[model samples]
Target chain A: MSVIKTFGKYRNLLGELVKKDIKLKYRNSYLGVIWTMLEPLLTMLVLTLVFSELLGKGTKDFPVYILTGRLLFSFYSNGTKAALKAVRNNAGMIKKVYVPKYMYPLASVLSGYVIFLISLVVLAVVAVVRGVYPTLQLFWIVVPLAQILLLTLGSGMLLSTMAVFFRDIEYLWGVALMLLMYTCAIFYKIDSVITGTNGWIFKYNPLYAIIVNFRNAVFGQAPDFQSMFYATAFGAVLMLFGTFVFYKQQDKFILYL
Target chain B: MSEMSAVTVQDLGVKFHLSEQKVDNLKEYVIRILKHQMRYKEFWALREVSFDIKKGERVAILGLNGAGKSTLLKVIAGVLKATEGKVTRSGVLVPLLELGAGFDQQYTGAENIYLYGAMLGYPKAFLREKFDEIVAFSELGEFIDVPVKNYSSGMRARLGFSIATLVEPEILILDEVLSVGDVKFRKKSENRIKEMFRQETTVLFVSHNLAQVRSLCTRALWLEKGRLVEDGPVEVVTEHFEKATTK
Candidate 1:
């Protein structure tokens, strides 16, 4: 009921913001929103070709494995990257108007999620063509997907807050995302690369946990509940921390921005 | 949402710390922090300023540039945080601090109307009902569908003014916005503001134009170097400010 009340208050503003973001991304481009599908599809194809012989030795469904991990990571990266610029990009509006500060980051994350959801259609088609048929367990995909969304939202808020005060966050976050992508086990199996004491690195990566569970659900297996719990708990904690920091710091943002 | 006073300010102050060296990014900030190279000056933009506007009163803020006129409006509009003291508002407030604050250059005038309205917290349904009126008043006609980047500044101001004034707000905060556009639109907007005054809307306006302030507001507040210098009838304060400045 409270959620509904909040949504009722901001739905129009949020809708307009999301629409502006999506439209701006595709504006004047020939392909427009079709680029969302093409981008991932091409990346999946290239990675599948380049690494199939090299890293696909142990994995039964290499393309699906890579696609699943890549999409989720892309989802997270895009949301946070956009959010890092959200406050700075709207400095003009923030200085003049009094809308909730969270709306800018919220719109950025939602727009990325919208494109990520659309790209899933391409993932589904490619998986079926590669003989990884849809299974009943696919219905449970929402669990990890929801976790990824929360993580993205939390990450976005934190980044937006920092980015307003420190302009370097934009570039620093790019480097961080690259490291995150490599560590997320997108192109390799965890057992092959993560060995000995370093095993906890992959095991503790909240994104890795979410991606692995998402991969399981896609492979027609019930998701690993422990990983799901870990990722959800991680995302929930970040969400709380992010909200707290964002609200506390937002009032001072105009001064810094 | 109180009824007694539209806005109440007490001992408000805003201090900005102006750093000597610019920290352009996080790397520089971290380096400076680690090296203990950070230094800044405390610049007080507003100091011990206090004022109150009762419901249905039209008040104008007059001062020279950097007199904290815009700073005062921003603090009252809730866009800027006060470093000390407080401001309280009881009614719905709409601020026209800057024309086209959220307008996108690539977006059509019509699209910007919706976007700007949404930014102001109005739902699309409300904008839809007033969409035609906004367009007609702006006289933007076929240009409404054209990207705002191509429009002149006056056209953009027209669109912004139209949307902000579409619905009468309980409290209207205007900061040098009425002087926008050409003479005809200026007169039109001045008349529209007069209509709002007739409707008994509380108005807190900031302007350097003495004639406009004298004609539009019954009371005036004067600021000098971040301090409130005078607050009284419009004629008295404006006359005193004019005499002081000319001397």
Candidate 2:
């Protein structure tokens, strides 16, 4: 009952913020929402074409593999990066008017989620065209998707809070994300590069864990339950930490911002 | 005291830390911070200030520049956290610290009404029902469809004032936003605000215009250098404030 009441009160505010964010992004552009889908599809096409000979040899249905990893990585990266600017960009409103500050980051992340959802349409189309037929296990995609969503929200909140105080966290995070891209195994199979004890690194990389399981579901194969569980746990912990840091530091934001 | 008072502030203080050397970007800030080059000085904007507003009281805050008047209102509005002390309030409060603070310049005036209304916590359904009323009140007719960036300053202020005052909140905090629009529109806004006064809405207003303050408010609090100097009837406090500042 309390949860429902709280949601009832803030739901409209949240919806309005998200609407404003989405509209603002696509405003004044002719292509508008089409660009959200087009950009990733084009990226998948180019990467698949360029790297198919070099990196695609070890992976089956290489374009789908690259697209899946690329889409999820871009979603997480873009959401948190936008969130880094959320608090500072709204400094005008924050200084003059009062609303829940976290709403800015929440809306930013949710808007990126909207773009990510649009790009998923491209992913589905590619998977089907590549002859990777769907199965009942494809419903299992929801679990890893949920994990990514949680992780994105958590990262957004954490980055936004620190970005407010340091101003440098954004630049630092940019470099970190680029490093993350190579480690996430978007271009090649983990088995091709690492073996034995060294394989634990890829297993522990949360994105690799989620992406591998996601590919398994799409291919009608059973998921790696242990990897799936580890990824979920990793996302859950980060989300909790992000929420805790954001709330604790929010009151001081007016001073720093 | 407890039953009739709408707001109570006890020894409220707000301190802002001003760093002398500015680094707008994070890269420089990180480098400076790592080298222990970051330095900040504490500036107490409001120091141990206290006040109370009774239910249905229209009180004006009078002060010179840098006297912590806006800081006091901001603290009460929950925009700024108090460095020390507490604020207690009993009713739904709305603070118009800066008119159209969140309006998107790229959006049409019509779209901004919904955006502004939503920022003030009005649902879209409520705004949709009052859409005609707000546009008519703003007197922006055909121009409402154009982007807000093209509108004159007065027109933008009119749109903001119209949407904000459309809903009657229990307590209104006005930070010199009423002195907006042309003389004709100012008169119209004065009349609209008068309606709220008739309804006995508790108001905390900040303004330098003595005539407006005396006309609209019953009591006044004069702040000097972040400290409360006097609290009395509006006429008496304004008279004192005038002579002291002018001398």
Candidate 3:
């Protein structure tokens, strides 16, 4: 609820750091900004070969499947990678500034969004080339994008702040993200997921609904309303908890830093 | 001392905790889920500290290293929350706790002034208009466009002191900032402090240099082992503090 104040207070700081992240990363690269596309494109190529050529036998629209999974991966993996180091990395800035401290995590979320924007453009161009026309339903992506952003923010907020107090949280988050890839429908369809008891685990994951909705919107399929609601509710709870921890311990950051 | 109490702190204290990083292993981190232990049985940083300063009273808090001077100043600034007691302030406070600690090293001196000004809650337009005055006060000359990391410690301190004094804070908190510059620049900072006092700004001065306090402050408090040992005329308290510590 206090997102306005939390966001507004650290906007400049976050904006500056995001600029630094982008600028610092691409400065020396030969490919430069193209790395954003090249990265996901390479992942899509590898997975498309293994999943589509080797195993996508009966599957229609294999490229869309791979593209959807790549989009989801771009957000979660890149988001968590930025988030895992967000606090430890910003030790210099955090020690001096009196910000909400969650701004560091929020910055990672925004950076991920920036990268996601790049991938979205790439996917759209490829989709057009493959004879998929833009649909009016495609406009509904704004909803899932906002939801996944909040969902990523919630998770990133928790990890980034905790990473300050407990340095090992970063490593743990790395492992968690690795395991989370399979849990989310990143490489395969959720319908092909395990049935019964084990299926409940995948069904409840926030990224599950997020990726499903994104695929649905961009591919003209209907979304899972129940899972989206679950993800939204859980994302809210995680965000609130993240904010609660951040606000409560925000001032103590000076001492820790 | 003036009639109005500009700042009051009653029985303030702070404690800290420490833990080994190994306790935060992956298995324990996951199992405990960061069930933090706030009490590691660490020593108290401050305990039962109390003092007050009236409007326009240049009260210096003098103490040795680790005497809780900085902690008390932080408590007053509200940068650090007190574990106990209340700090009542009559108006806005600008706590210059550590000179230049908040300035970015990569930014030029000019950019840092605005950044600090914004952090200190001064409007951008005000900083723009006051830009020359700040530059004149800093005396950094052509170096104003250079990053602070390239500046000497004295240059950094001068700019920090300049920006801090630029704001018209009703309560000014200075932590050993008087000795940062050359004799001429220090004199300038002293004059600025005098000007602030003239304007009814309550001054909470912290320093190891007793002479500055004797000249600038009317009342002085001596902190020993995080407790107020004496509070009175500047000369009397410094003498008492010197004698007690020298023993």
Candidate that beats the other on TM-score, 2 or 3, i.e. the better one: 2
- Candidate 3 interface RMSD value: 3.8
TM-score of chain B of each: 0.96, 0.95, 0.89
DockQ value for model 2: 0.61
Candidate 2: tens digits of C-alpha lDDT, residues B51-102: 8899999999999999999899988888899989888888778887778887
Task: Report iRMS values in order.
Answer: 1.3, 2.1, 3.8
| Candidate 2 deviant stretches above 4 angstroms | A1-7, A53-60, A195-197, B23-38
Candidate 2 chain A lDDT trough over 10 residues, lowest sum: A1-10
Query: Which scores better on DockQ, 1 or 2?
Result: 1
Better of 2 and 3 by lDDT: 2
TM-score of chain A of each: 0.94, 0.93, 0.90
Report the error of model 2 at residue A71, Å: 0.9
The CAPRI class of candidate 3 is acceptable
Each prediction's total of clashing residue pairs, residues at least 3 apart in sequence or on different chains, is 2, 2, 0
Point out the higher-scoring one by DockQ: 2 or 3. 2
- Write down the worst ten-residue block by lDDT for model 1 chain A: A52-61
Question: On a 0 to 1 TM-score scale, where does candidate 1 land against the true structure?
Answer: 0.96
Please tell me which predicted candidate would have the highest DockQ against the true structure: 1
Write one digit per residue (lDDT tens) for candidate 1, span A1-257: 26567567667889999999899899989999999999988888788877876555634478888889999999999899998899899998899987788999999999999999999998898788778987999988999989999999999999999998888778889999999999999977788775598988887899999998899888889889999999999999999999899989998898888
Instruction: For candidate 2, give the lDDT of residue A131.
Output: 79
Which is the winner by TM-score between candidate 1 and candidate 3? 1
RMSD of 3: 4.1
